[model samples]
Target: MSIQAKSERALCEITRSIRTRLQDVYGPASADSLFHAVERLIQRKRRTLSVSAGPRFSEKDALLITYGDTFLSPDRSPLSTLHTFLQEEAGSLFSFLHLLPFYPWTSDDGFAVTDFRQVNPSLGTWQDIQALGKEWKLVFDGVVNHVSSDSLYMKAYQHGDPDAEDFFIALPPETDTRSVLRTRTLPLLHEYQTTQGPKWLWTTFGPDQIDLNFKNPKVFLEIIDVLLFYVEQGCRMIRLDAIPYLWKELGTSCAHLPQTHQLIKLFRDILDWVSPDILLLAEINAPWPDNVAYLGDGGDEAQLIYNFTLSPLILHALVCEDASNLTQWASRLPPLPAGTTLLNITASHDGIGIRPTEGVLPEEARRCLTELAVRHQGAVSGKKNSYGTVCSYELNVSYFDALNDPAVQEPQEVQVRRFMLAQLITFAFRGMPGVYIQSLIGSRNNLAGVRKTGRARTINRRQFDLTEIQQELGTPGHLRQSVLSEYRRLLSLRRKEKAFHPDAPQAVLDLSPSVFALKRGGLPGGEEILALHNVTNRTVRVDLSRYLSGERYQDRLTGVSYARTDLCTMDLTPYQCAWLKKETLISA
Candidate 1:
């Protein structure tokens, strides 16, 4: 069937659902009015669907996570500078580029979006964005949960404009909302003294940001419209930022509400019709169970969910040199639905999230991470727990610094290897690996940036001069060059193997406490992979013959060939990882 035809049919069902939600939130009379308006919107415009084909996610599919201004230069615009860097130094290193929120912002480093439709003037023009789109698949952040209070839409609502009545979440002081989840320790309400009256807006992340009310059907439609606008701007992936906080009821804990799930399903249906290949990435940094829930029914919700647990747990395993906790948590993971997969990354624009480690990591293990961060001159940020006590929420440090403690004064080579070991663990997982720009370039703690911004996360969100970074990378045997070269090599090799597919059936192997072993089976053919990593500093021997079926075998990364008899005993050096293929597949 034609995309437009399928969308027309789906539009009928969506309109009905919206009408029901409207009635539930705003009553029958108002619902009828809203439904009429939504009908008009559907008739006037539908999301455009292009007929051209795009690349699907596969073993070759790796993502690069970076802020739009990550590669900055005095001589050129940030976007243009970034484009040139990718073309010259890092052509095709990543299959996809996840451009973090680049909208005009008042605070929170672009999360507090002042304008959704317009590109940040400082970042460059929309044409630059389109130019990059010609090469890489782009993932745009849909910061629909909140907007900057300085936004025109917020100003209109603050000035008592009737058209903006349903724009934001404002409530009476007497309303009880103690049950709501607290993503930050700031006050729940941010007061705004407007011309008409003194109003309070719900601010989930912080004061400069005001949450939108999904209960107000108009606000929901506004989000949908903005999403369509993103599609038009060449986004192949739409990441729903903090979507769990979209729906709130006074008496309930407003995290992952049923209404939120319904809204996501509606989005999936709409996006499938509008752009079938555009992947919806859900950024839920909650417990492991809650995180995977976004991949509902395998395909109805998000196609990709941030593997939040992997970051903290992998750090724990590497720092503690014990994979027991990581193995335990991963072993208990429920089977994911067929059409959906997980997106794993060692680092991001934000700090390493700790909430995802609630049950998986022991208190001592958690403390170990924080102490190591402090020793490395890294800041540990926290949020208020339910008991009103501040607890560590995240570790703010560059992935390089996070890997090794400064107190020990480890050699730079050791730190680089340790960091790459973590990346190896990330690639070994049955998920698409996302390489953070800082980790790839071997960046250290950006203390100057933090001092300038007075934000802990700034320690990792350091902007670099593309030319200088490239020079350092070009210098032979330099730490940056070594790290960048190894990273490129790993990615280049990882892309060609079939056993590293994101949807492969993976089983955690209980080999040894010091080693993290995973068996990835069910590739393009009968080929399988036995991934082994020695997280500890000492060499660990594992009898791989038990896992090997036939004679022809090779390690995917090193290309070291061996017969099944020789594979019976294998020793992995300190922080070494090997992707041992069962048999050489001529086709792959």
Candidate 2:
């Protein structure tokens, strides 16, 4: 077939798939109008991209971008924030910008997507998102992992509407439903029920977020249409949130199941067949084995998987006061399939609880790690002294409480130092590190405000205040300056350092209980960089004669050069980090 013929065929198939999918969700007439809206959005995107075209986009050069309800500033300008962020921090490192679920919703930080076709007015309009997509690559949340029980479809389902009822997963009669559904994961929601009978709805997180049934082919097709619609709306990437829970099996956690991978692979294949430019990121909150599997053997599944393990490793090293845990984790990493990447981050809006690193630390140390996270989170809400005991380890806040906390304040310089250090470690470590916008400006958690609002997670979703951040930035010796400086330093090094890019795989060099060391090679230019971190509260020395045979190693961070074994007995200050680069083939 001619190239033009192939393009036309691909477009036609996508149109047909989208129409059928939308008809299943909405009626056929609504789907038609939605399809037209999508086409207009895509045209706008294409026109936007036409103005400043760079290198022609290839399939391999895909980026997974994401935004959330609280991802925006109070002014609700994710585009301007993203534009500045890409220009200042990311530059050309990323080709995609995923504006997370920005649509209007009743609860769960907009995860309960109310409208599939329109942008939430609280966030910018759909036009703003389309315009942003035009200038940069774009990704959006499928968020079909679960829908709000109060969602339009769910309401229809409750009202005995035949069409909308099939769109959601409903349990059997009350007695049969008890065998299949779970009531509450939270402390407060001990019981829940649906109108279909006395049957309890299966809620993994809460009563609000209802898990979708992927066993039903209708559900699969409906979500696939959502995917196609976003692609038509100019999204080049789609984030599959809470993917592990999509398919449930008896007597198991029902996460990251075999079918899950198959389904994601199917989505990947479809996108490849349709646009080739669009990518899927699987939000599978699983361990390394399960997480890595999402990448598939041929790199044909998820293009990006969250490096959920690595983020906690950064925090653990800081709190344990040793870098060894991080280095140990890095040592065990297997090589990833080509054309795949890990999304690494330190802190996010999501509550970082004890589950992520439960068994990773010694029992005695776990308490300290827990305390540090709580305190750090507490600091975000401007409630450093409210907790009474610093190491109390009280699982006090709820998910919603953290999101809505109005007092979510920025941390002080000392606190920001520890936070920024963790983030720097994230940046220097292997995989693509993500800097949460709140953390970048040293934004804090909201304590009193959340308490006032009676929402525990409110602090987690507080809007970014640029004016407050600007005022804080004006303070010469503030935490904001310190964070900004360290971030600039780390990001600048990442930009210049070839070892920290997409292709570099990490290897562990030292795994002592107190210190951690990592090696990064396979740079685009084939150069090698060695990073060593000291996690102990006191100085500790490690012999580098075994790792380095050269007479000297150059410190990438501090411009100092040392003879090979000089580092063998050299002591590192508490929480100090070193990045050294050398040619692999040095002649004697």
Candidate 3:
């Protein structure tokens, strides 16, 4: 067949798929109109702009997750300050920058977006974001589930503007929302004095964040346009924040509804047609099954889903001093669908999520984890379950503090080693590792910030001044310097090894309860690296003879060579991590 004919056939198929997905929620007539509108948008984009396909996955494709204001300067905008830091200090340590919502926001530290199309003036302008994009691939947040109550759409609704009347979900005050899933303890509906009358609007997150009504096709189209604008602003990936709660149904739990998945597929289809290189990342913090559902058969939904369970599981393993649960969960992780991978992250702006640990970590263990966080000067946040009972939702603490107790007067070196071990485990996983900016410097719980802001999540969201952080990182014996130096060395070494590629084969090794091991590569006589991490506070000996095919292997971190005869018994010091590659492979 001719190339033109083949292209036409492919486009028709995708258009039909999009139409069917829209029909499932908006019915045939509405679906027809929405599909055509989307097609026009895609065509117009194709005709007016040219976006190159982004670089594919490699061993070096790690992402640095940070807010635009993570590194603030007295003279410059936050985004510009961050750009300078990335170029000078970070260098090429990261391939992508996951810039957490940089748009104007009313609350939730940028999650409650007041404006979708413009950058927060406190941060830099679009030019600054594009400049960062030139240095590193960029990830932008699509906070589409809700908008700030102060947003123009909400203001219009308050004024009873006909165009904005159906923008949000407004129901009767007596409406039953018992079945609606809640991520916050705040009331599901907040009464608003609109021009028409007093109406109760659905506020899934909080009253300051009003939920959008997807039942209205106009809202969906508007969001699609917003996301496309992000692509034009040079974002290679768009993170759909709080996406699982996008579509609501009256008679069922308004989370992960079929319509929600369909809408994601529609977004995927449009992006695939217009800018094929752009990726969709779903930020779902639910249980394993529900979290993985966002991947939608691997190719049609989100290209990336946060590895939400990994953070809590790692904490549980380290605190409990047992790797059994972590190993078991890793062993059973199903093969990812094509074109999809998890974004392996141990820490982020928010606290470590407890919801993702459901079914994997027992209730007793979770409770134990929460209690441990408190002991370490952390806090626990709760959510209301369907039973109207409040349950522990997340542990709000810095990743470093979660693992190392602040009251313990241990040697700083010991704390740094133990913390890096947790980070090493994340790197050894079979996905792209996302490093939070705070984790890079081994930051502790900011209890002062939490107390000041009256938000538990503020414990980990401390914004650092550029001069102060630079001074700390420059000090020879400082904790921040030590952690970042080691982290940089490990990251540099990881990029050089082909075995650490995102698509490299991984096999979990069940050697010892105190050890977490992964065999990467070595499929069909390829290069292999045996990654071993000791998650305890004491030395643990592991036998590696059965796993090694070479007579000698060298530790990539320390460059220590071990003969096969010596592999039967090897001692990993407390909190030590080793990436062992065959001596022959290293020599070749």
User: What lDDT score belongs to each candidate, Candidate 1 first?
Assistant: 0.83, 0.61, 0.89
Residue by residue across 1-588, what tens digits does model 1's lDDT show?
A: 998897678767756666676666567888788767655654454545452335457888888888889999998889999899888877888888888988899998889999999889899989989898999999999998999989988988878888789688788766666677786888777788777688887888888989998887778778877887888889999999999988888777788887787778767765664566778999998898888888886467898999989999888888889999999888888888877888999899889998899888888888888888888899888876543567888899988888876567667777887889899888879889998888888888999999998999999888888878889999998888999889889888877777788877899988888888998868555557888888988888888766877777888888888888877888889888888875546355
Query: Using Cα atoms with residue i matched to residue i, what is each candidate's TM-score against the true structure?
Result: 0.94, 0.76, 0.97
- The candidate scoring highest on lDDT is 3
Q: What's the residue-level lDDT of 167 in candidate 2?
A: 58
Per-residue lDDT of candidate 3, residues 1-588 (tens digit) = 997898779778878888888899899878888888887877766664454456558788899999999888989999999988887778899998999999999999999888899989989899999899999989999999999999989989999898896999988888888887788988899988888988899999999999999998889889988888888888888999999899988767789998899999989988877777888999998999999889897568999999999999999998888999999999999988877888999999888999998899888999999999899999899988774788988898999999889999999998898889889998989889999999998798988898899999989888899999999999999999999998899999888888888778899999999999999985465679999999999999998878978898899999898988887788999988999988888855
Number of clashes found in candidate 1: 0
**Stretches of model 3 off by over 4 angstroms after superposition:** 1-9, 523-526
lDDT (10s digit) by residue, model 2, range 1-588: 997898778667756755655565445666677657555545544433322213322312324334543334555466565554445544555456667677778787778776677777655676777777766777688887777766776676666666655554544323222222222223212233446644345565567777676765556667767777787778766888877767776545456667777677767655664466666778765457777899986786887887877765666666556666666667667888887777776555554433345446566665655455455454211111111212221223322222223235533533554565566566666666665555555555666667777755555445544455556666787755666667667666666766777676677776466767777766555657777776555677776666775667778788777877676666777556788766343323
The worst-scoring run of ten residues by lDDT in candidate 3 lies at 47-56
Q: Of the candidates shown, which would achieve the greatest TM-score relative to the real structure?
A: 3
TM-score, candidate 1, is 0.94
Give candidate 1 regions above 4 Å deviation: 1-43, 51-56, 523-526, 586-588
